[model samples]
Every structure is written in C-alpha cells, then in structure tokens.
Target chain A: MDRIQQIYNDEKLLKKLQEDQNLTIEDVLENEMVINMGPQHPATHGVLRLVLRLDGETVVGIVPELGYLHRGYEKMAENMSHIEFIPHTDRLDYTGTMCNNVGYVLAVEKLAGIEAPKRAQYIRMIVSELSRIAAHMVAIGTFAMDVGAVTMVMWTFREREKVNSIFDRIAGARFTTSYTRIGGVASDIDDQAFAEIKQFLAELEPALVEMDKLLLSNRIFIQRLEGIGILPKEDAIALGVTGPNLRASGVEYDVRRAKPYLFYNEIDFKIPTFSQGDCLARYFQRGDEVRESIKILYQCLDKIPQGEVIANNPKKVLSHKTEIYSKMEELIHDFMIINFGINPPIGDTYLSVENPKGELGFYIVSNGSGQPWKLKIHSPSFCNLQAVSQLCKGAMVSDVVAIIGSLDPVMGEADK
Target chain B: MNTKELIVEKIKEKFGESVEEVSDFRDDLCITIKKDQIVNLGKYLKEDPDLQFIMCKDVTAIDWATRKKRFTTVYHIYSFKLNYALRLKSNIDDNPPTIETVSFVWQSANWYERETWDMYGIKFINHPDLRRMYMPEGFEYHPLRKDFPVLGIPGSLPLPFKAE
Candidate 1:
C-alpha cells in the first residue's frame, strides 16, 4: 500500500504517464474505459479485433488490429511457380475465388503476352458473375443476420447453394474452384452445365425480390441502417475505397466500365450509383449489383462464341489431357510445363477485375523466371477496412456492426 | 499526343532532372523519379487539371536484392476524370530503406505505406502511423525480403498441418 502510494505520488512517474498517454491527472481519474471488441466476435464477421475506447456506450476512438490470418501469400508466391499460386489466390478471397483466380490469370497472361480465346473470355465472365452473385448473397445474408434479421441468411444461402451447384457442375470443386488457367480455363463448360446456369438465372430474380421484401422493406432495418456510417464522395476516393462502397458514394468507377477486361467491353451493364453513401446505400448498391450481374450472365450466355477455350500457343499454355496422354511429344510438353512452369517475359503487369467486393488487383513482377520476382495483391477489403476509424467517429457502438457488414470484408484477403 | 504521351511530356516539363527514367509497358506509363520528389509529384498528379490522378490505387515496394538501390517503391495512381493510369517508382538505398509518405496526397496511402513497411522493412518518412501492419509489432525480420527462406526460418515450430 505504501509502495503503491509512493509510485502514484512520484513526480517523474506522473510526468511519464502524462507524456505517454497525453492525459491530464483529471482525465486519468475520469471513467474512460478501453475495451476490446473481438478477435473472435461474430459481429466482426471474421478474425478482426477492434480496440474501442468508450465513454458511456459512445465510441471515442477505434484501433483496428489485423493479420490474424496472414499466411505470407506474397512471400509464398515468390517461391512457387505461376501456376502453383492460382490455388493460393482462391484462399485469399475464399468466397469469391473465381474473381481472384481470373484477376491472377489475367495479370499472368498480360505478363506473358497471351490472351484467352473469345469463348474462354465469355466463360470467364459468366463464372465471375456467378461468383459475384454467390459472394453478394453471403454479404447481404450475413449483413442482415448481423442486424438481427435471422431469416435473411437462410433465404440468401438457399440461392447461394443453387449457384454453388452450378459451380460444382462446371468446375470439380464447389468452393475454391481454381477453374481458370493462365491462358484459358481448365475445361470448357458442357451443355448440361450451361442448362444448370440458365435454370439458376431463371430462379434468381424471384429470390432477389424475396430478399428485398424481407430486409429492404423492414422498417426497423432501414431505421438502423439509413443515414448511418456516411462516407462522403471525396473521402471515399481519397481513402481508395472501391466497388459498391465507392459506387454508393456516387463514384462511377467500376473497373468493368472504367477499364474493360475479359469481354466486359462487348457485354452491356449498368454501374449502380447512390449519392447517400450510408449503410443503407451500400446495402442497396449490392442488391442492384446482383441484378446487373444477372444481366451480364444472360448476355454472356447469348453472345458466347463457339470456339477454342484455351490459347493455341503450345509453348505458353499446357495442352489438353487427351493430347498429353496419347502423343509422346505432347507428354513431354506437359512434363516440361509442370516441371519448369510457364515463364513470362521479364516485366511487370497490373490487372484488376470488378470483384464482388471491389477492384481486386494483382501486380506481378516477373524476372524472366517461372516464379514471380514479386507479387502484390491490392485487396479491396484491406483498403475498405482502413475507413472504419474515419466512419465510426462519434457514432453509437451498435453502428459499428452495420458499418463493418456494409463494408463486407473478408479477413483472409485483408490479412494477406 | 495520346494520354500516356501527354502525361510523360507534362511530367518531363514539370521536373526535368528529377524524372529518372520513363517507360511504357503494356500501355501503362511508368515513371521512375527521384525519391525526394515523390510527394511533390503526388500533389501535382492529384491537383493537375488535365491529369487528375485523384485515386492512389496501390502503394507497394519490390526488393531488388542485387541492386545498389535495393528497394523500389511503386505507386499506382488512377485518374477517373482523365481516364488514365500512372505508375510512379522511386528507388531507396538506406539500410532500412526510407521514402516520403504520400498519405497526405491520398488518405489511402496510410495503410499501403504501413503494409510496405511491414513486409519489406521500408520506412516511410512523415507517415503518421509508421508501424507494422500485417505483421505483429517487434517482429525481427521482414518476411518478404529476398533473403528470407521460403520454408521459413529454421528452429521455428513446424506447421501443424501436413500437406496431403
């Protein structure tokens, strides 16, 4: 007790405390408590830890701690071959692996001066849009669930599962489908797979309507979300927020429209924009985006060319399995590709796609090697996560969950 | 002149000697400039009427292990108004490589700079929060450095799961 009193009374100790915390003695005595929200909280949606400084249920400051799921993806890319790293990208944005895979392959293809055929481009577009719908379903479903609407998850997931079944038919895997290859896709979509996609598209409009009826019209949901977590247009651009979040802030900067890639220029779609820039606006943008994706998918189905899926360059792209198995020369080519990997010219390329979240980019620096000299992922979630501190200022604690859900961050990509 | 050429010419006109090298790769204009002039370049790019590169898309660094200037920090800036993309590169030579912070120009550079520092050990001078981003604080080495082993440093605990 005497020691404690002596330390408290000491001038040096008091001065040190004041310097470190920038707090006056009076401020220290006042009841300002610091609390940790989660590295495990369900509201965070993933392994995100928010250190919130609170003064009676109002957030004074927030420090977001990240990297709970860092798997050294960039470092791993440096070590592995270009083809080997495709699966790793799937793990980055696990929910929207198709976009991640396409982004990576597109960058690699650019580096190697190769382009996927017209049919392959359309197929990539279709799968990417399908993945976008699946991802948005999870985003909206989980968002609704976070705001205390439990049935939204069940409704959205049912639709998501239907999409997953289509993915299962096209690619062997349902979740982390590494269907995209560097110069093309692994296999062409069959008639049955196409029919399944058409079926899914038929049912999607009604599902979206059901979702709108369930959550968008809910008065309590709107009351909680509307006019909350407003990110102004200039601030959104300054902070580098993209995709629907930036669109909600009235920035018409969808990568698909701004910089067309993979037959997006040929297809027609609308970039949804909302001037509100609040949680409700962000939610509305996602709903609108799912509709736009449906339009693109339909266009892709109608306009897709009937031709080769993979590029004809045998030196760059691997041959088909039938050719590799039957012909000795083709078998040797396969062996060489698998053993040494496809080496791109010594250069760097940056390619991004309009992911369900935002502009997911891959910046690859190739030194005329099988493996990349350096690979950097410009993850949308990581950039969007940075705005939380700016958005949460002076807001009630409950708004944090809505704001985070609206951002729709996946920790895997953010941490990487 | 095309947008790329105009950008190159404008940059050359603005800062003659400061612009080290300009290259065009796959239609993207890349300009390597003096490290000290990056912040000024960023401001010019953002505020320039013709070249309104308001959005700093990404900021990252590459470790050229064999080079005298061991690190090159790359910035990808996009102009929605002008409809062009620019790549800015600056080489750093400090033992712990240091470059000027562009967070003031674009608020998004804050986290990007932090991640660069965390991964490559490049310090951003005048950065408000120049701390480890993805990596934990007090971590000994930058994992993304060329010298770091791919299998990871020896004597560390083996990964729990084995490859099937």
Candidate 2:
C-alpha cells in the first residue's frame, strides 16, 4: 500500500503520463478513455484491432489497426509457380475460397490468353455462386450474432454445412477445397454431385425463409438495426467499398454485370441495391443477393453444356493423370510443366471477379517466366474495412461492432 | 471511338509528352506517365465528366531490382460512367523511391497507397497517414521488394516484451 501510494504520488510518472496522453490523469479519468477492442475479440470476427477513443459511451474516434494476420501472400506468390499458388489463394478469404480460386485462375488465364471450355465456364459460374451463398450465410449469421441475435447463427451455419457437404462430394474437401485448376476445375461435376447440389438448393429456400422470419421480421431486430451507422452513397464509392455493402448504398455496380466475365453477360440476374446505406440495408442487401445467386445457379444448371471441362491448350492446361502415367509424351509434358511451370507471355493483366464479399482481383505481371514477376491482390475487404472509422464517428460503442459486422471483412484477405 | 481509344486520345491531347507510353494488353489499357505528372493525371481522370474515373481500385508497386528507375508505382482506376478500368503506371527513380499521393484525388487511394508503401517501401509524399498498413511499425524491411529474401531476415520482427 505504501509502495502504491509512492508510485501514484511520484512527479516524474505523473508528468510522463500527461505528456504521452496530452492530458492530465484527472482529465483522462473524467472525460476521454481509450480502449483497445481487439487483436482478439468475438465481434471483430478475426484478429482486427480497433482502438476506440470514447467520451462516455459515444465513440469519438476509432482507428482500425490491421496486419496481425499478415501472411505476406503477395511475396509468397512471387516465390511460387502459378499452379502452386492456387492453394494459397484458398486461405485468402476463407469464407469464399471458390471465388478467390476462380478470380486467380481467371487472371492467369487472361494473361496466358487461354479460355476454359463452355462447360467449364458454366461449372465455374455454378461453383462461384454456390460459394457466394455459403459466404453470405456466414456473413449474415455472424453479423446477426454480433448484433445480439445468436439463434440466426445456428440456422445459417446449418445451411452452410449443407453447402460444405455438396462441396465435399464435388471437390473432396469441405473447407479449403482447392477444386479449381489453371484452365479448368479438378474434375467434372458428376451425376451424384449434381443430385446433391440440387437437393441442397431445394432445402435452402425454406430454411432461409424460416431464418428470415425468425430474425429479420422480429421487432427487436428491426428497431436495433434500422438507421445505425449510415454510410452515404458518395462516401461508399469514394472509399472503394464493393460487394453488398456498396450495393446497399445504392451503387448497382456489380463486376459480373458491369464487366461480364465468363459468359455472365448471357445470365439474367438482378443486381440488388438498397437506397438506405444503414446496417439493416446492408444485411437485407446480402439476403437479396442470395436470391440472385440462386437464380444464377439455376440458370447455370439449365444452360450447362456437355463438352470437355478443361481447355485443350497444350502448353497452358495440365494433362490428365491417367494420360501422364500411360503415355510417354504425356509424361514428358507433365515433367516439363512441373519443373519449369507454364510460362505466360511478357505482359501483365488485372482480372477481378465479383466475389461474395466484393471484387477479388489478381494483378499479374509476368516477364515471360514460369512464376509471376509480381502478383498484387486487390482484396475488397481491405477496402471495405476502411469505411468503419467514417461510419462509427459519433455512434455508440456497440454500434462499432454492428458497423464492422456489416462490412464483413475477412482478415486473412484484408491483411494478405 | 470506343471508351479506351477516347481515353487514350484525351490523355495524349491533355498531356502528350508526360504520357511516356500507352499500350493495350489483353484488352486492358495501360498508360505509363511521368512520375511528377501522376497527381495532375489522377485529378483529370477523377474530375473529368466523360472520363469520370471515380474509384481508385488498387495501388501497387513493381520492383525491377536492376532498372535505372528501380520501382514502378501502378494504379488501377475504375469509372462507372465510362464502364471501363484503366491502369496508370509511373516510374520512381529516387534512391529510396518517392511518388505523389493520389489520395486527395480519390479517397480510396489512401489505404492502397499505404499498403504499397508497407509492402514495397516506396514513400508516398503528402499522404494523410503514411504508416505501415500490414507489417508491424517496428519492422524495418519491406517484404515485397525483389531484394528482400522470401525467408525473412532473422531477429527483425521483435516479439512482445517479457515481464521480468
């Protein structure tokens, strides 16, 4: 007790505290308090640390400190071959691994000037939409859980598990399904896989409707969320926030619709936009997107053609394992490819797909080499997370959690 | 004329000599302009009515370890009005590469510029908050630079202080 009193009464310690905070101890205790919310917090979803400056319960300022999950993926991409990096991409936005895989392979394909066959394109579209639905489930569930609705998480995860099982049947892995290959998928979607997907899709609608009634229709949920943490349309665009968050702000600019990659031009689906730019609108925007994704998936199933899954680009696409084992020429080709890697022409190209979270793009600069000279990933979560400070300026401390939840930033992608 | 051709012509007309090289690779338009002209070009691209490149999609740097101008800063800007995206590249020849910040032009450039700086160590002049984006503040080496080894330098990333 004497030692504690001595330290508290020390002039040097008091002076240092005053200097560091630019305020006396009394002032800090009376008015402003700085609190570190994360690096590990349940509401933050991952290792995102938010240092919140609070005056009573109201947040004066919030600075989001990232990089706790920094894996240096771009540096790793430079070190490995194009095919060798596909699995690495699965770890980017773990919720939407399929979307990341497709985004990456599309970039590599665009650089090499090789197109996946029509069937493969439709398959890619199907898998990407499925991945979108699964990702949004986690987003909507975890977001509801963040805003004090825990039951929605169980319902959403149940649906997500069904999607995972479908993936397991198709890709042989549930979570980190590195199913996408360079010029095509690992294998064709067999009859059993199609049957499972169709069954899951049928089961999904009723489950989603029930979940909606339990959460979205509840009076408490509506009152808690409606106008909390509003980001205007102008700010949304200026900050480069994409995906459903940007759509909720009334931007209507979807990469699939605007850019039209892999025959998305032929597909008829609405880009759901909500004028309100609030937390509730962002949540509803994702719900609407799931409907659109279902529509796209149905269209894909109907319009999928019967042909070769992989493109016949001898230099670019990998050969079948059976052919590699049996044929001497195929063995030599596989050997050369494994050793030297597929050499893209001397050029660079940036191709982005409309991922579930936002636009996941890969900018590849190839110096006519087996591996990329430089690979830059433009992750949408990293951009969307930037708007949190602006949104949470004068809101209550709890609203900060809601705003971060609304952004749905996966730290793996954000810090990559 | 198409949007790409229109953009290229306008860019050429506005700042002809500053536009170092213009190339269309894989249907994407890339314009390599002088480093000093980045700010002016960014402003023109954003504010111009027809070429309202409102969103700065990404900012990254490419390190050519042996090149005279060792680093090239790249910006991918998108326009909703035009329904097209353009790539802007500029070479930095300084001892420690320095370039102007385009955050004032497009607000999205703020984080992207910070990330580029964190990864490549190219300084963005007049950036609002030019702190490290992904790496720890105490960490010295830029991981993305070609010269920086893949297996990082030992003892560079300091661990948390232990309570004695």
Q: DockQ for every model, please.
A: 0.77, 0.90
**Least accurate 10 contiguous residues by lDDT in model 2 chain B:** B134-143
Worst 10 residues of 2 chain A by lDDT: A21-30
lDDT of 2 by residue, A1-416 (tens): 98868868998987776678665767756788899999999999899999999998999999999999999889989988899999999999999888898899999999998889999888889889999999999999999999889999999999999889988987889989998888988889999888888888898889878988999678877877899989899999999999899999999899999999988999999999999999999999999999898888888998999998888766778889998889888788788778888999999999999998899889999998899999999999999999999999999998998899999999999998
TM-scores, one per candidate: 0.94, 0.96
Best by TM-score: 2
Candidate whose lDDT is highest: 2
Model 1, A42-154: lDDT tens per residue? 99978999999887778899999999899999999998889999998899888888989999899899888998899998999999999999999999999999988989999
Q: What is the C-alpha lDDT of each candidate?
A: 0.91, 0.91
